[model samples]
Target: MSVQTEINLSQVVVRQSQKWQQLALGLLCMASISSPQYVWTLLTKPLLARLDVHLPVLQVTFSLLIIFQTFLSPLQGKLIDRFGAQRFIGIGTLLTGASWIGAAYSQSIWSLYLLYGVVGGLGTGIVYIGVVGQVMRWFPQQRGFAAGMVAAGYGMGAIITTLPIANSLASHGLTQTLVEFGVGFALVGWFASRGLRPAPNTDPIPSATLTTGRHYTPSKMLKHPLFWLLFFMMACMSTSGLMVTSQLAGFASEVGVSQVVIWGMAALPLAMSLDRLTNGLTRPLFGWVSDRIGRENTMFVAFALEAAAMTLWLTFRHDPLLFIVLSGVVFLGWGEIFSLFPATLTDTFGSQHATSNYGWLYMSQGVGSILGGPLAALLYQTSHGWVPVFSVAIGLDILTALLAVVILKPWRKRFLQH
Candidate 1:
């Protein structure tokens, strides 16, 4: 072989290795930050016991966490875009860890609200949007699959910690567990953040796979009706998913299945662990499917699946074994929005200013958190059952599914035409 050809092959190998390294680091950073949200349901009983609060009032903490995480993402995204990923992500992870450590010492619910809700939200928000937006820029050719992998880390990261945290809550108590794990997460995430670098400059792949070839800034994108439609659809999807996420443990106990043993393990933790697996799996699964079938088509299928799974879940909720299994199914149908929406957004709006644009869209999840976390709890308090809450979620899922196909696809096509 010629020396020139060998040099070219060597460069290709180096590039491939670098890409995978960045991907792995991004995944680690995502997983490191996931626990505050994903494991929150597990924390509720202990928090309620410690704080002596009403259910809806306690839920406000969760709403605050998500509200801050998502609401501030635009500003966070802009900063990451300007000052670079490593500095912001490092600071974000430290804040996230500090939130947990502070929560460990917090005696009052209000203090917990400030520490776990506001601080944790800001920290995780910076890491979450920063990492996902970075992934969007890095893998322009494979945004769906790449975003899915990192989002999967965030979705499924809790699986490893759920059992440990549950066991710790049983033995060591919440305070010790929070401090120990918080420190570990902070260190690991900060170290991983150092490894992240901006995407390298490359010539645009001519008329790349599905992108509109027209870049839209956050300001320009905000004016379009289609953006609002997509926002509404995402908010619906987020509401369904976050409702289950934040309310799972509460609803299980309410239904008298929380303590029931399924396969020698308590049903709630088993369901939560399984839900994480399915949640993580679905991001990539649906993302890959969307790459082939188109985003709206994939949305219709996944959203309909969630609606159907929710119906079965609500129907057979009293059966502990079925409850555990269907919770996974419910998430399987729901979690892909994390992957699909960002990919679709970058595809439509263009990757220039992708992070900032997604930050604005990410705020929709904050809306879902409010509706799903506090309002849903209040609905339960008033209605005296889980049926009403689940029914509303199911309706949103079906409506969003229909909108994806009937409205979004054609509207996007027309918008792109001009």
Candidate 2:
């Protein structure tokens, strides 16, 4: 072969290696920022104990974290796009770490709300959108799986820290645990950001993928009825999932299973760890399935699964063994929304403004956080039981599942045909 040809082949190989390396860095960034949301349940008991706050009042912190994480995503996405992913992600991670450190020293509930809730949410939001958007561009042919892989990192990252945080809460207390984990997340996420670059847009999409070749700006995308349908569907699913996520520990205690031990491990932490695993696994698993079976079909299956698991969970709330197993099942169904919605959105609107477009859809989670987090707690307080709360979640899950296949399938098909 000619030397020019040999050099061309070598450069291609290097590019392939760099793409995979970027994927790894994206995963690390996601995992590093995951703890704030996932581990909030574990911290609630400690925070309540330290601050002597009411349950409904304390739940606002959870809502604030999600609200900020999602509601500001459009702005964050714009900034990441204009300024570059690496610079913003590194700064975001540092802010995330600092939020935890500041929260550890907070002497009042309001202070915790600002530091842990607002600052942490902003930081995680930057990393989440930046990494997901970058990776989506990196592997256009395998968009579902690549997006799923990093989304899984966020879903599952807390598995590594759950038990450790639980132990530290038991031994060192909440203040110390937050400081240590904060430092670790900051360092790891910053290091990962340094290795990431924006994905170039020269790669072609395979003909098999049903993508709208037109790139729609966020404003145009918002005017379509189809976007509203997707927004509603996501908001419903988010409400159900975030309700369980933010309120699991409190709900477990209400059901008399919080203190139950299975296999020498506390049921809450054990169940939480398993839940994280399944939550992470479902993103990629369902994402890959959607690639073949179609996104709406996959959503129907996964959302239906969550509704079923939730029904059984409420039925057998007293069984600690079932509690641990079923929580994993619940998450297995719900977590795939992270993968499915983004892939579907990008497929429909095109990737030119994918991050910004998804930013609009992601705001649905903030709506869910409000309805599911503090408001749900207030509902529990007023209704004087958990049944009403769990039942509401079940209804929303079933509603969303039906919408996915029935309304979404036909509407999206017609929209894309144009």
Residue 189's lDDT within candidate 2 is: 95
Clash pairs, model 1 backbone: none
Residue 366 local lDDT, model 1: 99
lDDT of each: 0.90, 0.90
Model 1 worst lDDT window (10 residues): 201-210
Q: In lDDT terms, how accurate is model 1?
A: 0.90
lDDT of 2: 0.90
Worst-scoring 10-residue span by lDDT in model 2? 203-212
- Superposed model 2: Cα runs more than 4 Å off: 1-11
lDDT of 1 by residue, 36-83 (tens): 999998888899899988888889989999999999999998888888
Q: Per-residue lDDT of 191-220 in model 2, one digit per residue for the tens?
A: 989999877665445444557468888999
- Model 1 CA RMSD to the hidden true structure, in angstroms: 1.6
Candidate 2's TM-score: 0.97
- Per-prediction TM-score: 0.97, 0.97
lDDT accuracy of residue 245 in candidate 2: 96
